[model samples]
Structure formats: structure tokens, C-alpha cells
Target: MAIAWSGSLDFTVERSGKSLMGSAVSGEGLVNVYQGSGKVLLAPVG
Candidate 1:
């Protein structure tokens, strides 16, 4: 699998205890996740 974004962007990813959250931009659209723990969240912008 692959994630691609156009141009350039800066983002911060934070993890507390067992949770993770971040915001990112992809060629297809916006990508984000909040309060995620112990697993992977894959969202396809396309």
C-alpha cells in the first residue's frame, strides 16, 4: 500500500499512552485520525 500527497506539507503526529492522532493531506483529499489505539486505521482519500 502507498500514500501520496501533492506539493509539500508539514504535520505533527502525537501519541499518548496507547492512542495516536494526526492530520495529513493526500493527492486524493484530507487524511486524519483521532484517539486511535492498538490498531491501524487506513482511509483511502480516493
Candidate 2:
């Protein structure tokens, strides 16, 4: 999860390096990339 409180920011989702093994094997290897300047919050969900 991600939240941008102010200014500007960019958010993207991409396959993680481990994705090469496939989701079934790697447990959905994916990641979130955030760029730019801002007050932001990032959290992980299980």
C-alpha cells in the first residue's frame, strides 16, 4: 500500500527479480516503486 500526502509523486508496479521463477513458484514476485518528492507512506500487506 502507498499514500502520497503532498507535492508530487509517481507510483508503479513491476515484476520483481524473483518473478523469473513464475508466480506459482515465487509467490507472486512483484514490487512497488515510488518516485519523486513528497510525504509518503508505504506499507506491506500479508
Candidate 3:
């Protein structure tokens, strides 16, 4: 697997006791996960 991109990628993933919620996000350049970025969506097929 090859990862090709520029800029900085920062994330502070954590867990709080009992929880099944996972937060997935995505953005580029000045748009960061902390400086107010967009969200990534994941779907569960039924």
C-alpha cells in the first residue's frame, strides 16, 4: 500500500469506557479535524 499526499494529518483518537461509536472524518490542506473540517460517512448494508 502506498500513501501519497501532502500537508499534515493529525488525529486524537480515544475511547470512553463503554461505547460502540467510531468517528471517521476526512479533509485536506487547511481543513483539519481540529480546525473545523468535514465529515466522512460510513454505511452498514442490511
Ranking by lDDT: 2, 1, 3
lDDT of 1 at 14: 40
Return the top candidate by lDDT: 2
Better candidate number, 2 or 3, judged by TM-score: 2
After TM-score superposition, the amount by which residue 40's alpha carbon in candidate 1 deviates from its true location, in angstroms, is 18
Which digits, one per residue and each the tens of the lDDT, describe model 1 over residues 8-40?
334334432332332222223343433423434
**For residue 19, what is the lDDT in candidate 2?**
50
lDDT of each: 0.36, 0.69, 0.32
Give the clash count for each candidate: 0, 0, 0
Each candidate: RMSD to true structure? 14.1, 3.2, 11.5
The residue ranges of model 3 lying beyond 4 angstroms of the native Cα positions read 1-10, 18-35
Best by TM-score: 2
Angstrom error of the Cα, residue 3, model 2: value is: 4.3
Q: What lDDT is reached at residue 32 by model 3?
A: 23
Candidate 2 segments exceeding 4 Å error: 3-7, 22-28, 43-46
Which is the winner by lDDT between candidate 1 and candidate 2?
2
RMSD to native, candidate 1? 14.1
Worst 10 residues of 1 by lDDT: 19-28
